[model samples]
Target: MKMHLWSEFIAVIKKEVVPALGCTEPISVALAAAIAAQKLSGKVQKIAVCVSPNLMKNGMGVGVPGTGMVGLPIAAAVGAIAGDPTAGLEVLKRITPKDVIQAKALLNCDSVSVNVADVSYTLYAKVTVSSGIDFITVTIADSHTQVLSIEENGVSTYIAPQFCSKKPQSYDPFKDIVVKDLYDFAVNIPISYISFIEQAQTLNEALSIEGLTENYGLQVGMTFQRNIERGLLSHGLLTDVIMHTSAAADARMDGAMKTAMSNSGSGNQGITATVPVVVAAAYLGVGKDKTLRALVFSHLVAIYIKSQQHKLSALCGASTAAMGAAAAITFLLGGNYQQISHSLSSMIADIAGIICDGAKPSCALKVSSAAGAAVKAALLALDGMHASGDDGIVTNDVDQSIQNLCALVNGSMMQTDVQILDIMINK
Candidate 1:
């Protein structure tokens, strides 16, 4: 692979995968609040935030890290009170119990409000924090941490250049690429060039261990372990994959303080993309370089597919992330590029319709299901069983298969997002 192409691939990975402290929607809200609070004088007296409908939907039910709470109000309040603006997505990391108390008090006093913003971007947040008469506003849009503008007392202070970014659509580096480009890059690239990618394993696995050892969320991952000890569930590669993958999701969705190496702005998607590949590499006894290669392949593929969709969609992100896992697992199984493509098609065929109701404890179940399907999809592809064009969405061309999924969600099923959010808010 050429160095320029490698640079592009690395650019996408660097932008997409990073450490996030909580479900990204709430974390982004906290980040906005933190940035806004930083520009204000004295103690924070009030916080008002407007987030996109998609963000509102996801943040409504998910846990906010270390606060033992769910939703964006507390996140914004705590952020304004104690969050670190420099921490970016990990803005809520330094929050103390006292901060939680103060945040909850702000909520009690009705000093914080989170409303669905009528924003042009699908993923957007506008946060305003007031300290008596001193106030500041911060707007984040297009991607988490992409601060669009900052204003103090109605005077503009900063605006992001958004160098490569255009309107209504994100910049697309992979527009001319396909699965083969990712494959060649992962396989042919020097191992030294991509060794830093290993941090994903270190970070996500910590959450997995935390989830399994302690009680968090639904305990979906821990339950599998107990079932195995009871001889109800067999101890094998699949179980190992599920235990690790779902455990991470369990801890993350439940608002564990540990950061997850998120892909495409979602912690669950990160867990889905990372854990299965890690477990499968260990199960196969692959070398460090090989494991890293598979990791890059899986992550980039997930990023590629995920970047095509509305950042927050009713289409479950785990579906695309797991497809990446399926591809990497097949590659580890010593399958050729054709089989890797087949693995993706098979994954799409099996897990295509998994709707994302919202982000919460139950998301662990979804990631686990998608992880299992990934392994199964890889195995079927290794056995030369590809989903042909005759199937519903799975097509002869892998790229078109991906387009089919994107088109379905971004077009006809867009109302699915509206209805889902309406039901969630109403409920």
Candidate 2:
């Protein structure tokens, strides 16, 4: 890739690798609400939220980190009470116990209601706030940070969402990236950017430790660790890497308080892509540049998968990200471009159909399983193995393989996604 192209890739990576407080779905709700709150004058009294089914699905079940509460109502309340819209996904970063108390009070007064939109989009949020005689409304559409409208007192300040974003650009990951590029980057990027991976190591690994301490979630990763101690599996770099990485995921999905390094908005997805590659780097003793390159490859592959998942789906984002981790780990382990492609193909072939019912503590088991599969896929690829392209949704080309996986997520699985949410809410 040209230097300029590399720079552009780096820019996109920086944009997507942002810090988020709590689960991003609710935090995004708070972000929308905060924008309306900021526009309000005098004392704000009432707040109403309108969200699409997809947003409501994610916001419904996940625990908002720091607060024990579940769902969008409290998120909106926190937004109205203490959120800073300008802070974006980190809007709730400053939330305190007092703020939580006030937010719960707002919830008690029946201040929030989430209704499905008449028109469906992958992402949407509408927030209305009333302050005595003053009222403000804000709508977030399509993309985060791209608020479509803001109105107060029957007057509007027109700001186009396009103004905040550069002209629309399409990304072709394979055009600029091949297995060689991924491998070289993993072997040669700077330390500073890759150092962020440490946060994944510190926070997620700690959560894994906590998970083991308390026997949280399905105990998949922790259970694997115990089996290793029993000599069921040898103590090797691959085993250690996969175990530490997925164990943290086990803890996080099971409601550990630790925050994950969120990528494209999902915490478990972030952990899935990050921790595995970092653990590989640690065990392999790769230099900082190599580590950074691996981190970039891991993170970007996750982002690309997320673009297809589009923030909502029956297909879990962590599964997609774990596939990316499989690719990155393959490259880091001296696999060629063919091997990397094979690992990705094997992953999609194996785990492409897992459903994300909702954000719940039980997600840890699913995530650990995915991570374990990813490691296995990478190992198989290293041994000159590849999933047959003729097999179940597998494709010969890497990009086509990604497309096939995404189609299962986006096109053929909408009903499965909606039905799961219905079951959760009705039950």
Backbone clash count, each prediction separately? 0, 4
RMSD of each: 1.9, 3.3
Writing each residue's lDDT as its tens digit, candidate 1 over 222-320 gives 999999999999978889998889999999988899999999988889889999999999999999999999999999999999877877888999988
Mind giving the per-residue lDDT tens digits that candidate 2 earns over 1-427? 3334555556766677766556777777888888888888876688888877777777786767556777788888888888877887678777788988988887888766677676566677888888878988888876655687888876877657565679587666446454445545544555564565556556655665776666655676777778988989877766776677667766665445566677777777877887788778778887756666777788877776677665677898888889878988887888877888899889988898889887766676677667778888999999988787798789788777888777777786988887886887688
Summing lDDT over every window of 10 consecutive residues in candidate 2, give the lowest-scoring window: 174-183
lDDT of all predictions, in order shown?
0.91, 0.74
Which residue pairs come into collision in candidate 1? none
Off by over 4 Å in 2: 1-4, 163-243, 250-258
TM-scores for candidates 1 onward, in order: 0.96, 0.87
lDDT for 416 in candidate 2 is 87
For model 1, the superposed segments whose C-alpha errors exceed 4 Å read 1-3, 163-171
The TM-score between candidate 1 and the true structure equals: 0.96
Report model 2's TM-score to 2 decimal places: 0.87
User: Which candidate leads the pack in TM-score?
Assistant: 1
Error of 1 at 340 (Å): 0.7
